[model samples]
Target: MTSSAENSGQPVFTIIVLGASGDLAKKKTFPALFGLFLHGHISPKTRIIGYARTKMDRPDFLKRISQHIKNTTAPKVKTMLDQFLDQSTYVSGAYDQDSGFLALEQEIQRVEREAKIYDRLFYMALPPSVFIPVANGLKRNCYTTKGINRLIVEKPFGMDLESSRTLSKALGALYREDEIYRIDHYLGKEMVKNIMILRFSNQIFGSCWNKDHISNVQITFREKIGTEGRGGYFDEFGIMRDVMQNHLLQILTLIGMEAPRSSNAEDIRDAKVNVLRAIPEVIESEVLLGQYGKSEDGTMPSYLDDDTVPKGSKTATFAAAAFHINNPRWEGVPFVLKCGKALDQQKVEIRIQFKDMGNAIFHKDVAARNELVIRVQPQEAVYLKMTQKLPGLGMDTVMSELDLSYASRFTNLTVPDAYENLILDAIVGEQSNFVRTDELDEAWRIFTPVLHKIDRGLVPVEIYPYGSRGPKHLPEFVTRFGFERHAQNYSWPETSQTSVAQAVAALSADSKL
Candidate 1:
């Protein structure tokens, strides 16, 4: 951890949230700050200022920001929230103008004079339209010369390769790469963070994490709800830009990258960039796109039914694409990425299926292939599906899981939200969990061609029911990329008895042993 005083020689820290009146600020940004404050990660000398064009009083602003914070009946939580809000004040300002920023600078200077605050961190929760102007405004009028000035920007960096480069170039001119944090909240996820540790630290996984042993890798993200009237924004990006190109691709890099020389941020990011460079741009033939229609029942509306959506919009609500890296370690091994909104279930997981034991002691029909599954959300977990001998007289095999479900195992610990983790990383100058310039460039390169094809309506969009899993061809799409579905039925045991124990009991009852 980089100490504020040691790195910046500053005794106090101030965080200024741009677009403070927006939904992102109210729901995620403020809640995350409150989490840091509640956990005592924030310093007593630290101050917070909210900046936006909406002219509202401090009390109303406070009320709006705190409304989404997780409720607790405990008095201590309430007290801490009050203290956090007390340190936080609102400053209404236009995003594109120097006058508003100049006023913001004066307010910051006033707080600094009173509290001796020097280090400043700006969080941009505004739209991409205002990003450049706001960035320029900050640099021109609100920047601090005496201490560290860090800027955290959110994603949809740009529409495609060219636009992303343009945005990157503009931001690079304003702030040095080291001073900017490109926030990809997915990188801060608990299970995603565990990928390197699980592979590098464990010899069992490290030895087999290659093309020789691993057959296929699947990374999937599914959302159960539709646009729900937010189709205007959803139509512009579609599922590929919104999820696969950034979040799912980041997860894939972590899974496919070589072990870094050290835990340094540059080393880790360099390894990730190498992995990204090895991946060829997505081919149109290898991609499947789908837009959601109404549910099977008439109760639900289709994507086209949304009032905000354009008539006959060809935007894809779901996508499944196969990616392969042209490197020695991962050569020919398929990395399948799938993401969709208005699916049957909400899940984010990485599943690595190992090679089958060909002509081994057990028949292939009885013994299933080994698989390492990492569930990133809903209930964080790392479990490996393995085959074991049935606890009975018969020479049969059963499949079960070696599980590490976070909720069941770590009862007392609360996993910090993704935003909380990334924000703290920014405060301490940690860059490994944040995206880099070249990294962003490579990511955009991999998907830009496909994105353009979709944008130009060159690719056909398949229609799937809103509540269905995805397009009807999804099974064949994954199978084409070497993913194999387990033939035998299996489910992780959620009962009191372990899987083996339950199997044993069932056998004993059947045989009267």
Candidate 2:
């Protein structure tokens, strides 16, 4: 029982998950904990306590969380899961009331005493309405003084700039800046984490990461499904708040930030903050908003079709905006952030389109500009779309890729869930990947004006078929920002019937003079 403390010479770690009975907890939080335990990132003595208002027995609670964990026939997975469940227990509690918090505190104390645990992490998976109350309750009733106490908060941090600052002010009073982890799960993504390394560590990329060589940068998040039954929640925040504001903007900072002085977390965040400060507030004219309608065949439902949605709701399920950083490095280049639910496919990617080859030997139509694409999910990949001669005897040029598809390259490794990586970072006190207070404030500043406009019916919401790409003007909108879409057809070789090795070899052969 004390082996974790004995082996590591460190105190046991405990994670107290608020809103444990909620969907986010069961689907993401617990499964992530199981991942960390399976990977041996946490001490075996680690204790997981789930607190929520719903009353459920230990067995029932275990059943709910375990449902989303990977289903495997492997005995090791099963054993690890059983052990994870063994270390976890549930407590019923009201978020705001003192009585429920007192019960939660007692249970936590019992675990700490039994396991000799000293550290605690509270993950808030509840609605934003309950965030303040739960934070206050934990601070008053459950905060541990003997060891580290960390709080992990999820977002829609607030509806807008004023609200975000208000929430930050309240939380700051309760917890020191270092003790709070504002979770923006996108920061935990494999590719997003790789952005810094990809830019600074590589000379070829580092040399040209500027307005002079790069035409435009696009950070896109697309979902194949709509809000489903969560229209009420979706309507309030809309796509601007839900996806573009936090997740996509976080990606932009990583892409646009200068190299940090050192690898220290604060230095890295300082670099990101500088990027945020350079970005001006979004202009409503530069933004295109859209809400999904029924699919072409009328089989799929629209955003307003959900009974939970208001009849005249104009909440945008799709948003595309052009942002310009006024810094010397990226003065004129547009950083376009596009996000939509109920689109053609599910993909999250950062597409950096380099300036068209100038004074080139090839005809304009023959060569497409080099594009460095980082596909973040469904199949993680970082591929460069470059020009090459067709493999045949002809001089015709073709677009090919220098691809590093994770599936093809890292065949044996399984990428950890975003939550798992972030939760582990919180336990170890790493803040580089988490958003800071000032970073949150700056992010809100960029989006608040446009958000307010949309809320007040000043901006129009275009409607597109649910299964289609997005608003019909999406192509034109992106084009307006100087993002050129090549007319020639190009596809990622890794997705085709040809193997990655074969595709790379063919490209190598074609490149020969």
Candidate 3:
């Protein structure tokens, strides 16, 4: 546990944000740092360095990003904003050159020496194209300090397996895996982190979290908004690499992995690697791919229409795959992972399905099943659907949900942002919240073949209208793995849910048209 004393201890650190003026740095990266300050998690002596080509001075940087912070966070965050502003210094420079790195290195030294703490942390918030160059420059210029805890890199880790491997190797040449924090914001989500506790910490889930009692798993990451002017980047990467491989697969690993020997990062990550290593070697015909067509509404942009994207792009906006872990715990059980843009709804979830009623004593006439859902986005909560006796009937089984919502349950506690938790973890040398380099490579390996198929148009990509459940073939997609069109037996409840296999089984039955 991060005790109050630990949280409040040691006030000195030189924290540098390399791409200080970009969208991620302004909207998410900067605000997350402020959140740590607000919650008293960051040390008081932590000095922030904003490094970028943007030739802005301190006053301009603060004024511009302050509004971004406040808009993205609560009004009470102003106190922390003032404190962060006091320590923020703007550095104008390019990422590729040595002069900038030299000047930046001096700035870090000045901060550490002045603040009386020798800790140095550099955060690369720039685009992936610049990650390797900046990383190389940092190794050449900034990694000279002693006893530095860690260096953190944000996600979109790499394009695919090869690129991820190259990036990991490049970074490894700079810092050890433990000394490098690869941030996957989803892994930082309160709900995503809860997956472990929900399974390991609770006996109810721990007992059935294996093949014998559970059936299959579904992890979905969907966004209702189009690329929103990020066409160049979105077109190049698409949903498979952007959403499914890292974020969605990380969630699935949490759900399907055996309990680690210990909760430490290495042990936990080891379990995930084993599962990822067992990805189906045979041709995975069960996978479904797609690009979203323009909406009949005439308001959104289609993949081809986005001028920033290359013409004749084969990139897919939606992707779904049914995979299995060959380990004893989840051997034959299917773990389905799916993600897409322009979805009918905004959602991130894990659905767990328990075995179907072989022969039910109660309401055998009605379909009966039990499921659990852990909803991750829009709102966060858990829901359990099980058969219950209809009040007026003689043991007639009807499905209903028992719900728990974090918003309503934990009053007065606004959970720290994912970046806040992850960044602070990196600051304090806790690797539990960040993914390892091996984990990133393993993640890409699982999807490399499929991604290539998607890129070359070797695999079929069914285009669906914007804001639809995604290719109408989704029901058939799950059926190949023995799942009926979601459990006709259940429907979701409010705050109301997220993801898991049993929950999807219950949901499938109710969703069958």
- The TM-scores of all predictions, comma-separated, are 0.95, 0.95, 0.90
Leading candidate by lDDT? 2
State the C-alpha lDDT per candidate. Answer: 0.91, 0.91, 0.78
After TM-score superposition, what is the CA distance of residue 181 in candidate 1 from its true location, in Å?
0.1
| Candidate 1 lDDT over residue span 84-148, tens digit each | 88888888878888889998998899888878667899999988889999999999998888878
For model 2, name the residue pairs that clash.
none
* Superposition error at 318 for model 1 (Å): 0.3
Model 2 C-alpha lDDT versus the unseen true structure:
0.91
Using lDDT, rank the candidates from best to worst: 2, 1, 3
Clash-forming residue pairs, model 1: none
Question: For model 2, how does the per-residue alpha-carbon lDDT over 242-326 read when each residue is reduced to its tens digit?
Answer: 9999999999999999999999999999999999999999999999999999999999999989998999898899999999999
